[model samples]
Target: MSMDFKIENVLSMNGGQTDSSYARNSCYQEISLRILQPYLEESIGQMKMVPCGRFCIADLGCAAGPNTLHVAQIICRAVQKKYKALGIGMPDLQVFFSDLPCNDFNLLFQSLPLSVPPDGRLQACHYFAAGVAGSFHNRLFPRSSLHFIHSSFSLHWLSRVPPEVENQMSSSWNGDRVYISKEGRVEVAEAYLRQFQEDLKSFLRARAEEVVEGGWMFLFFSGRAGACPRQQGGSGAVGDILELAFKDMVCEGVIERATRDSFNLPFFSPSALEVRELVEEDGSFLVKKMEFLSMDTEMKIQSDVDFGRMVAKQFRAILEVLIASYFGEHVVESLFQRFAERASQNASVLYNSLRQGGGILAIIERACTP
Candidate 1:
């Protein structure tokens, strides 16, 4: 499908703790970094021991702020420390923070703190942050320019929602909220799989060009476990809870059933095997390491009261945005208020249901050919 990515619209809410902060502290970051540290160490070892030369690092899908830079900083320091232990001077590094055009670059720039030492020893650090503004499948940087590329909590977003699904009027009416029945689940899964294939091809091609040989790229995203047709008990609980919540909205006539089915959330959690296959399929990159960790969404709640409040708050926050986008901004508050009442009651049941429905974190690195 020829998809025009509305970068600005998608990132309209990408600020504050909700956007960058939440991701910063997410388990995905913690897990992915653990996998990344060694590869970074090895890469630093291979590079010429230049004491004052510039090294390049890029964060793809950097979003709008310091969160990306913060992660980059951590990586840089770790690499520098590794070199310092070898009695090597620090290399001057150029860090690039890239995202879609619609991202709030002004906010990111404003939030960026100065990176100089008090004594002005020229910390050997220079930053070049910009909005790539186009799909990652397309050209974003020069070939072989990047040493390390990183992205997290993205990649599942298709270049566009499947055009066939978008074009099919009947497809839209297939679900109430996010619930996909046996057949509906199969169809939707196929569509998502197709989207992933297409997007991954483009993404791999683009990165293969930008990343230098032996350089690494780390990606952390959400995906499902096992090959289950219908989301049910077990690891499917989050899907179930979201399905139930959407059904409540449908029953209340808050959203068209068609919209729910036709517009699936732009995310997927691939199995570790599935990820390995993707990495191998590209043939340009080799799978260095892949590990899956169970991440419970329920961990957001510390207490019963907090759980209740979080359920209501998350529902309202998401619903307000959805209602405002599809309906009118005027009805957003009212719609969310009504949804919050129902969400509070459902929170306990949903929390229990999803007690085991955590997420997965995967890290892939670029392989160096002999």
Candidate 2:
């Protein structure tokens, strides 16, 4: 409902293929992509009704870089492979990579693969990729134009800080905190919950208009399983880590305490029931699969990674864009420095919190009519 939260205001990921950047920190995104790969293949492969012509696919909130297009290619290849198996010429394909305007499109295009020589492959020369700069909270494509829509690790963000929480005089203001903690005010928590519901519904409604009847969408983001919004006992959750660092900064006179109190992150983590309710209420999507899984449970522990640094890279990539925009560029360096230090200080606790972190994977189909 509120458009004050412009996409350009947020920060983009660490650009380029640098080893210490988001390219390396984004392992969890890869893991999520794999989890949804089979569904992409099977659903698109088996679609008997998709019109035989240019097929449109959009990856909403596709942050800049190789990985974004890389995942889309995986889905694209699966469809082409299926068409080849059926002894038919492949349809023309156009992919829309939509994200915030601040996203590094130049860097992403630089990373795009030039081309695979046409060895008489199924979809050779049939695929075209382009970046569409905008928020997924609004319509990004023409009506009934998309065959598949995919978004990962993006939807939990609210469009803006709720006005109730933003009002200086309101009791709901998230003072001295950047998020709704276990000890947060009830009104603060309720404002956040209300904002998420509104934003998610708007997203689904817009996508419903853009996607064709029976078209599929796969959504993966951080979500909790139980009835509560906050995951109990996970004190090392990124929100907690950030808050801890903020507290330390306050005590040392680096940043004024009121500054931290006034700044609440424009984000929330919904429970499974909450996600389901929003989808059902939208009335234009049929819920197919709703799963809440632990992010680290599926991982095969890699011996090489320094766990604390790995986690810090991801948090910085995600929050840096907004933090730098609101807090100032000078604070960015020291903030993440402190974030990594805090994470390393309690390695066991931090790793356990990550292991216990919740992720949601939901597959929904657009109804022909609302």
User: Per-prediction count of colliding residue pairs?
Assistant: 9, 2
TM-score of each: 0.76, 0.89
lDDT of each: 0.56, 0.74
lDDT of 1 at 268: 51
Question: Per-residue lDDT for 15-99 in model 2, tens only?
Answer: 5666546666687777766666776677667664443777788988888765787777877887677667887766877788888
For candidate 1, write residues 82-167 as lDDT tens digits: 56877876666667777666555666777766566666454533444444565676778898877777776566555655554455
| Candidate 2 residue pairs in backbone clash | 11-321, 176-261
Off by over 4 Å in 2: 1-8, 18-20, 85-89, 114-126, 232-236, 297-306
**How many residue pairs clash in model 1?**
9
Best by TM-score: 2
**What lDDT is reached at residue 84 by model 1?**
82
Which of the numbered candidates is closest to the native, going by highest lDDT?
A: 2
